[model samples]
Target: MPATDPILPATNGVIRRSGCAADTVAEAGAVSLDVLAARRARSLPPGVRYELKGVAFTLPPVRALPVDLPESAGGDTAELLRLVLGEEMIGRMAAAGFTLGDFELVCEDWRRRNGLADGTAPLLPAAVRPGGSR
Candidate 1:
């Protein structure tokens, strides 16, 4: 939540670019998106472009509001694009001097904009956690 964060943007996300897509998953109580562009911007490999047709977002396990619920139970409700790039992508970015926490913040910002819950969990895990039920 820095003022100038590219993902969150101080304008409350009103400056979103065209073509970004988002959706809410009622069962998981989360939101998702096909933010390949955002992922690429996060420093994924050049040839790693893949269409993320549908993905979900939720709060991390440790940060869940109700500790009793599995991390899968849901914590936040935001567009999936806010989640961030996958591990391989982050690895590539890290080699190029990207900080792990920075991209995590990007995902966190996405969550904030989508009205999703907040969690301290890392982005890589949270991004993949919802797929088990798929």
Candidate 2:
């Protein structure tokens, strides 16, 4: 990826804000929900989709990683890893000896990469604000 490009490029294509791949349209890379919360930025635009290996998956515009959740929260490890770090990232981290406990560090790296400050905060869905219920 170019230093000027804010989005991360995948082997198949670009991962959109919605986590969908667009063969033609280049998109800004996925943003961490924590980063958005830290900056008080608005959520990503709606209706975005991600494509991988010619298959598309509908996802939220802002891809929030579950880096803050405790392991006891319970879910598929690989799926959780994918949600937060993306496929390529998970692979790289795994190759480098990443563990579940390192999720916070990954989140911190993501925040710093996006030029956001390092901090802890709950990642609420777009429909649910910090103090509001879904």
Candidates' lDDT values, in order? Answer: 0.41, 0.44
* Tens digit of per-residue lDDT, candidate 2, span 9-115: 55443324564333332345643355346444345334334433334434332234433442322333334436544577556666666666665544444444444
- Which portions of model 1 show Cα errors greater than 4 Å? 1-84, 120-134
Candidate 1 residue pairs in backbone clash = 32-80, 76-116, 76-117, 77-116
Q: What is the C-alpha RMSD of each candidate to the true structure, in Å?
A: 18.7, 18.2
Which candidate leads in TM-score? 1
lDDT string, candidate 1, 1-134, tens digits: 55486866453333345675543343444434436445645542222222221322233322322323334334432223223344555455556564546545655654554344665332335445556433
Worst 10 residues of 1 by lDDT: 44-53
